[model samples]
Target chain A: MGVTSRGFAVLFLAGFAAQPAFAYKIFVSNEKSNDVTVLDGDTLEVIDTFEVGQRPRGITVANDGNHLLVAVGDDDTVEVYDTETYERLHTLPSGPDPELFVLHPSGNPLYIANEDDNLVTVVDLENRSMIAEIPVGVEPEGMGVSPDGSVIVNTSETTNMAHFIDTESHEIVANVLVDQRPRFAEFKSDGSEVWVSSEIGGTVSVIDPATHEIKHKIEFDIPGLRPEAIQPVGVRITEDMETAFVALGPANRVAVVDPETYEVLDYLLVGQRVWQLGFSPDESLLFSTNGVSNDISVIDVEDREVTKSVQVGEFPWGVVTTPD
Target chain B: MMPARFLLAAAFAVAAGGAAAQEAARLDPDWPCVQRKVPTLTPAAIWTGPAIEEAGDWRDDEEVRELVNLLSQRRVPQDEAEATIESFAEGLPAEERSARLTLLFAGLFDTMNAERSEIIEGIERYARHQKALVETIREQKETVEVSPVGTGSEAEQQLFWNLRIFEERRQSLPYICEVPRLVEQRLFALGRAIGTVVSE
Candidate 1:
């Protein structure tokens, strides 16, 4: 049973295509160190670290589950890398200062936020060129793709608005103003509501996608701390669409909230200045990247407690894990 | 050039659609402003800042918290307010009947000049205080960004830029010009009252 080069390639691709339900590898984008740190998702231990662009912030596992898409702001390009080999594949036409992005379900067109330029650059994955540069609000950071892939939302920090763009037309159909300094946007698995976290407002605004208006707000109140310190930044809803975890920027806590009630259930204390979050493919374990502490805290989603902390590179800004 | 036009068009469209977010009040609208909305400081809390039992975060620095409590009122402090306007309100009625009208007039002019000085001094202090607030926020920001526990080197370049922008004279200086006019209006009203009393 000798495996030739072609047969090995097939086997390699099959391993990626059919990701085992239990296998998980977490990738963290470190901004200050200009690298990406890979971790064992189960043990929460540092597996490897590879040099990326000048300042890598936003990272995402490609929908195909074989590549990692990282928005290198300093380089003004979204560099793709082979998930297994950890080698740079190519760069996307992400315009200037690409910070965060969301890929289409088909993984053909990529929607990226260019923070400095105040535009969302849509690049065609097949052509490796920009398809359309959608003009968004100032300092765009968060990108959310709908479950049905019909529309995508981009939240602007300084603008303090969540903009909904029609995927087909690639135009902003509506803009809904939320609280101050909106940093991240997330849609429920069922596509019923979209949650946007306002860093300065210290609250998560639950907006109705159909109405394009804020339905309710989820606020945090930590014991012995002022409300101002509860800066909500990263938000992720669970696969079952029952729970949501929001990363508090300076508060160093992740608030577990009920999606239906918009009530904060509990605050899970993690490392310092928790910036972004990731989850395993099976949605069992959740990972949080603490930039100030330079570590990743793994939490059992069911238990809602931080089980382990894995030290990584400097100032980790984003995190993504292998797909199921 | 195209981007400029696109930006203008987008602004106009957003304005027309009534979907633009409310623009925050800035000393200078042209420059980027720092986020200052503290959640615990409700409208009622701002109205009665000193009465707040526990302003949790600001408690670390008693002096800064005190200053913040004062600024939350959105006006000059009591001592400065008194020296500028309140003294004039009560100064004239205290003069003796034997006090010459001419002397009283001279004193009134002197008092106005003194009030002017105090208002100018208030502007300087206010600038210094606001600059300090920027520094405090920068230090807090660096705590999570590039402080001892975090990565990077000594000194924060973003904070330096933040301080410069926050303290830019063009922004807050206009407010300084307005304070004097408002204080003078108060003094002028008091002077009129003094004149009427003498006429009677």
Candidate 2:
């Protein structure tokens, strides 16, 4: 017993010493609470919750890792905050009801999906000015930028299409019809494929980037559960393109799929109404924001299991991790 | 109009009891909305002016019944509704104004709560119907795939049509989800509009 305690002390000291290398923070936007819950990425413990504007739905860490950008939908603005102090820096103008957004690979311009106005608002992060408002289909909610920063896609819930826009031109290049209520679009790291998740259609359509045609529709079936319960929403593919994780909203599970085969590998049962997901900087862990349950589920990526569930604020919607 | 706005704000505060309370109160698993699944709202949730129990039979009063019907319909704008309430109370005797307005609120609350409950039930039914159709669509697709139905064949065409119709129905869910909140807001506004006319 004495040796065990001494060994644990040394390991704790080692962890504290190595904090600089792996020190990161996970920011979760709670929609109802209108605040962001910040957690220590290493310990997976809540560090703080900072209040923001009304209806804070989408949140992301700026590429610089020094600032956090949150889409306050009701306020019709994207709020910027200091990452370390959780202080409000300023607000960027967005179109009405900005639900989700994505930063360019170069990290200068940010693309926002204005659901109410059916437009994608692009803003220059450095200057904090509106760059352009690219019109898309009805109720644009999901925003995705390609790895090369050439193309950005916005999924419209009512129109049921994935509208791809060229970043440089800020114009619609292609409108590929997917299943109904496509809530999210995720591009593979190599820019070879784009995966869009349809919430009501209950499938993820894999579109070929070059051909702009859907190559596969990945459907999930969990035994004893009705098909409608398996509503696909947020999707994320690993950097290596070996695996993909799709958040099955209201099904209370996350489906793991083989990116190459488009086959369901496993389902990790999470909290109630899991809508969004994020990955740790090293991709060692995946966190799911369970809106109804008001908690975030920590998934061990290597082990393919939920390791822990941490309670958060009300109606947690979006999540992003700092790269530091 | 000022009092109506205040009541509307109060109603929202009551409804925004956080997601944890919502989860605890929600019993229906198939509810598919971002808003809390509140089956019904009690008078205490929004009313703050007077005791509703002593309001008496609001339906028996012809004037109160007519006003209730008009106020319950969300088509009437809140400002217009408030003006109507103010004019009605101004015509009433000063001693009877508070009692009459309280009766008005009781009538509005009862009628709106019932409407909201009905809408919630309808939403649940819609979800159940969608679930059944999803199964049917899956089976139909499998049959079309297994049979010798060529592309553009009748069986394949039927499957395509069903899928399209299914999606069209699914698209209405978001709009339908807004109805309950709309009813609550209107009720709160009208209730508070009457409150403004009553003597403290």
Candidate 3:
């Protein structure tokens, strides 16, 4: 079993295709540093830190794992980068102040939440052109798309409504009002429910995607923490749609909840001001971007414990993993 | 005079670790806000109407300066501010409206962004002072614990008051943290109002 370049390449390809996940890189957007910290997922070590546009907050990898998109709010553009080589590819014409965005499940057009413009700018990822600028509510920051790419949900922080848009038409189909300062929206993998996290309202509203009505409101009550401090920001529901992980901003914990029962199963403490979350491809590990603490807390999903804390750039705001 | 043990217990009660943790997370260790410290705001963040250079030498215009002062005051309600901007634009001749509105936005951005920056600096200073107070309290507590009985009374009294002050400021931090955001929000609203006038 002598190691060779060809053999290593074959093994790498096979590793991604088969079980026993390949060495995926975790990308974290540092808001203040204006850079992305790349960490080896398997080893959980800092591989590289690359400079990005100003105020890079929301970050995600393309479905094919070829490109990485970063929403640089101050730059007012989604910066595209070559994921493998960390090369600057091009920029998407994201409307003014793009804080967060979501890719179509198939990964074609990128939907961005322009916080300053009150619009969701849809950009064609392949062609690198603006497709549409759909008018949304005030301070639209959080964006999510359905598994089938039929609907796109934009949660407006000030308006406190989840505006669901029909992907094909680019027109708002429904507006489901939730609590105040709805900062992030997440859809269950099965598309059965939509979870909106309200930062100021301190609650997570579980909306029935079909009916466009509130199904349940999940609230946090950590004994020692103040109610106002328990603000919910980002949410990730498991592919099975049985469990959800909600990042409680400033409360410094991610609440594990049973999406079926709407009960908080447990609260795992992470770094301060946990803003967003990302999961490994296998769903075994979860990574949280802790803004104030400048680190990512790696949570063991099955154990429900924070296994490791990896320090990165200043004010880390978003996290995403490579598909491989 | 408070007893040494009582002073020691109070000294141990200081939240130095929490304060240190908060400071350690940031580049300027003094920044205590959970919001990423943006020391200053770029005009692009709020002002989307026209290039700021178009409104250069806005300070030379007394009326524009006055309007900037009036509008930048957060005490003035947003709706009232919008009405003022609309009225100001309406009173101007159609030819002068866009230039005047652009000037107004530039002045407002300059005034408000500077004000916001000052507030952020003040917050950092406040946090720095708070950290010093924690350090002093820690030292005084050690003195009270190790020193012979009544000799440390003066240090104990100082430590007690410093602890009280630290706690008071810590409790007030969350509110102070909102000040910069509030200022930015006002600037955003005012900028939009000015943009509406220019468009109309």
- Kindly list the per-residue Cα lDDT of model 3 for residues A184-241, writing each as its tens digit: 8899888888899999999999888899999899989876456877889989988977
- Which clashing pairs does model 2 show? none
User: Mind sharing the TM-score for model 3?
Assistant: 0.62
lDDT of 3 at B101: 87
Off by over 4 Å in 2: A1-22, B1-200
The TM-score between candidate 2 and the true structure equals: 0.63
- In the range A1-324, model 1's lDDT, one tens digit per residue, is 456988999998999888755557889999989999998765677889999998999898874789899999999899999988899999988999999988887776889999999999998887798889989999999999988899999999999999999999988999999899999989998888999989999988888899898889888887656787789998988989877899996676788988888788988767667878878888888889887667777888999977766778988999998775
Enumerate the candidates' DockQ scores in order: 0.01, 0.02, 0.01
Candidate 2 structure lDDT: 0.84
TM-score of each: 0.60, 0.63, 0.62
lDDT per residue as tens, model 3, B1-200: 45545644554464434555456444556777766677776664344466878667789889999999999998898779989998899899988888888999989888988999999999989988877876787777666544445455665566666766776787798899879877876776677568667877
lDDT of 1: 0.71
Clashing pairs in 3: none
Give the Å error, residue B124, model 2: 11
- List clashing residue pairs in candidate 1: none
Per model, the share of native interface contacts recovered reads: 0.00, 0.00, 0.00
- After superposing candidate 1 on the true structure, give the runs of residues whose Cα lies further than 4 Å from its correct spot: A1-22, B1-200
lDDT of 2 by residue, A144-237 (tens): 8889999999999999999989888998989999999999999999999999999999999999878899999999987656787789998989
lDDT of 1 by residue, B75-168 (tens): 5553363343333334445453213322333343344445656765665565556546544644546463444433344444444444444435
Model 3 chain A: which ten-residue window has the lowest total lDDT?
A: A221-230
Q: List TM-score (chain A only) for every prediction.
A: 0.92, 0.94, 0.93
